[model samples]
Target: MLYATASQTVGPYLHIGLADRYCDDLTGDAPGLRDSRIVIEGRVLDGQGAPVPDGMVEIWQANPNGRYRHPEDERTHLPLVDGFTGFGRVPTGPDGSFRFITVKPGAVPDVHGVPQAPHILVSVFMRGLLKHVATRMYFPDEAAANANDGVLRLVPPARRDTLVARRGDDGALRWDIVLQGEGETVFFDI
Candidate 1:
């Protein structure tokens, strides 16, 4: 008789072969963007608020003109920055911290052509989960745009704040991910 294989969690060794691909600075090669550059920093926390130091975080976003570098983003009218890739991946440090340097993305349209709030698509991969969790990191200053965002409306008002990153005194955007328990960061089904 055939038997099913047991499920395995995401990682402890994710960095082994992926180290060469790690890119924390999306702005390193890109220059002369129309929008201002921004720093996004965050930590991955567990149920009891302890850090998950071995996780990986990845982000995808549009350029300042709201156009992705990928061919699938067929809005040819929107100019693409010469060196902007619109994608980044980095591993959590010993303190469960990760940082990315990039310009703030512009609003992209949904399938219906309605504009979405300026946000970065995020994916978290860590141990204790068979699949990665997906979420969005919205800009705190884009309150008006965020309020009208179709995707943001899908999340309850009370929990919506979890998706918005807070601007710290140092001016870097900070967002924390809670795997479970009280004050958990919202994860989308996708």
Candidate 2:
């Protein structure tokens, strides 16, 4: 009998081995980056809007020139910055807050050659989940580009606001993720 193994939730101790790679800064003080640096800070909230203190958030994005650091990104026309890895991971604090410092990513082209909006791909891992949920953090300032993004178009108009991070008076981007219930964040099936 080939019974499948039971599913398990994501974590209670995600920070164990992951702490070594806990990078909150994608741009490691490297100069020559073509875009302005930005700070993104946010909280991971449960359905009731309480913080999920033991969660982790990971982000991947293209460089400021719209090129990824991965080998598969054959866009040689886009220059990669010297010290920017374009990837970051941060564990949530006791208040469920996480922060990242990086340059604003440029628009990357989709598979069909359509340009996506300047956005950071996010993955959330926490307790009570069989697997991580995927989402995106779009810049609120890039409204025109966001409007034309193929991926953003797939999200329902009424729910798209969940994906856009708002800039605060302090000049940092603020985005909160709600795991479930009312005003839940729009997570993708990927």
The digit string of per-residue lDDT tens for model 1 on 1-190 reads: 9999988887577678898999988888766853578899999999999999999999999999999999799999999988889899999988999999999988899999999999999999998889999999999999999999999999999999999999999999999988888879889998
Cα lDDT over the full model 1: 0.91
The digit string of per-residue lDDT tens for model 2 on 51-136 reads: 99999999999988899999999999889888898899999989999999998988899999989999999999998899999999
TM per prediction:
0.96, 0.96
Off by over 4 Å in 2: none
Where's the lowest-lDDT run of ten residues in candidate 1? 27-36
Model 1 regions more than 4 Å off:
none
Alpha carbon deviation, residue 149, candidate 2 (Å): 0.8
Give each model's whole-structure lDDT: 0.91, 0.92
What TM-score does structure 2 among the candidates reach? 0.96
Worst 10 residues of 2 by lDDT: 27-36
